[model samples]
Target: MNDSREQYTLANGRTSINALPKVSLHDHLDGGLRPATILELADSIGFEVPASDAASLGEWFEDSADSGSLVDYLATFDITVGVMQTTEGLTRVAREFVQDLAADGVVYGEVRWAPEQHVAKGLTLDQTVEAVQQGIEQGIDDARGEGKTLRVGQLVTAMRHADRGLEIAELAVRHRERGVVGFDIAGAELGFPAGNQRAAFDYLAQNFLPVTVHAGEADGLDSIRGALFDGRALRLGHGVRLAEDIRIESSDDENTFVSIGGLAQWVKDREIALELSPSSNLQTGAIAAWGDDLQDHPFDLLYQLGFTVTVNTDNRLMSNTSLSRELSLLSDAFGYDLEDFEVFQLNAANASFLPLDERQDLADTIIAGFQSA
Candidate 1:
């Protein structure tokens, strides 16, 4: 029940994963609320919680998310979202969200959230965005006050199942200078294809907003194709299912032959980063085809094949994980050393939506951080 991440050390005791500077590309805002905060906020709003205490509530989220049912997993958000219906709630949650990421050693993080979902208490979309920005800035200053420095950007997201895609897209573009860095679509990726939000995608594309689609997770190749072709996604969220297009023809003692389809070829060639969340993938059954364990993940395969794969914690509260813990798990399963961890960090840095010069600077930060470690 205690899913809090402990300090993770590599097989070699020389370096600690917790001490590394990392970039988190695909973390969600509503999905990362602290349990104790959730309890207090729910009380303020007179909403009932499933558990009486923070630890019990945290365990409930982790347990329900691991049920391997998207329906059950999504049901947990009803509680978190319930608490975030006010400016105070949103600011507190967003501020604490950054503090949590900074504490986990995240140097830069792009936190995504669907603003439309948080307007149930009569908050306009713009008000919600401002409230969250306020919290983010406060959290950054708070982290610095404690001698930790972190930068955060907002990725305004539209729910794939909702009809306000275009509205959300405009809101994101409006806030481009106010911490919003990118746009995304998340929620039921199966029937609600990215094509359903084509108008929004087209709007963002014409406006030159960077986009990342929640593809190749709940659906297969066609869904991924829609994300790239229609959604114009600069990156793929939880692209673990992109493996469906790859066919392993043969395996021998000395060699293994595999063939890739055109889509996979394009993704690899374009260097579009795959925001892969190993623990969350298993919890949601996203990687069930390969097997039900971390070892069965296609991360190493993708890495070896030269695809831009960056690690992430899709939902820290539900998955009960941190960025350091995710890296540590990958290291344990793949026998990765510090240099390999550096490569992963560098991969995330290069794939981030920062301006080219800034992205390069992030890469340099990772390099310098790793060198010192």
Candidate 2:
């Protein structure tokens, strides 16, 4: 169940995917907790878990999430989030989260989680953010001690179903100098449009804080439009459904003619990054409109048509996946090579919430790593 330790390679088996430097843009903090940690934390708090052992717990997560619905997939978080209601729980989870990312060859990552969800134990929003930051710093040092370069930032998220959007936005901006990098709104993406949180988006915009919205996953084109026009998202979380705007006019043996809708055209022209998680998309039924298999994913179509598509493991524990495993699955599905893998990593690096100079530095590091490989 420890997917980070697994080795992955390109379709030709000439290069190792795990050896390359990578950037993760859409990883969820609460969704990536280790099963053993959950067990110990839950025991300390006298909370009940679905499984007694680590292996069974891991399997249960994967199996439950495979129900092919976003709501059903997210229901598994009740256990993981239940254990993260204390300072020790939050810090330890965040620390191990980074360690796991480093072990998976992630040079840089942005961990997203809702602060309000973790304050159930009477911790203030600021306290929750501080605890997670403490863990992130510790995790960075831990990875450094292991001789792996790692940098992580928190994306303080507000549950879309809640009325604390503006409060969470301020919390994110309040901790910008610490470990927080950006802001996000995630939850049920169907009824909760980004427009409902317009006040928070306006606040973030005025403060010049970057944003990424969980859109185009459980909903269609209008949801994406609201994310762009209202939330002012610098990136789209699981923007897989944006493919709906594209009309496949015709296709032949070698040529596939297509027409892009105005919205898709704007997104393409603006180069908005699509934080696409292949496994999570399938597990959440986000890509069910296209097909049931990985090959049915529109990632290749988006990439070939020049959309800014980035690979991510939206929820590693839920999907029983890692960045390397996701890349390997995509390679298997579409004959991708090391060069294509490098492109995906570079795309993620550029789309990250880091400053432009640091993003370029990350891009250079990725290039150097790929060249060495």
State the lDDT of candidate 2 residue by residue for 254-331, as single tens digits: 676799999999999998999999999999999999999999999999999999999999999999999999999998
Q: What does candidate 1 score on TM?
A: 0.97
Local lDDT at 169 for model 2: 98
TM-score to native of every candidate shown:
0.97, 0.98
Model 1 ranges with Cα > 4 A deviation:
1-5, 251-254
Candidate 1 clashes between residue pairs 3 or more apart in a chain or in different chains = none
lDDT score at residue 228, model 2, on the 0-100 scale: 99
lDDT of 1 by residue, 1-373 (tens): 3232478888877687887999999899999999999999988889999998988899999988996656677778888889999999999999999988888888989999999999999999999999999999999999999898878999999999989999999999999999999999998888999999999999998999999999998888999999999999999998999998888765567576889889999999999999999998998888889999999999998988889999999999999889999998999899988888888889888888899999998888889899988
- Each model's backbone clash number: 0, 0
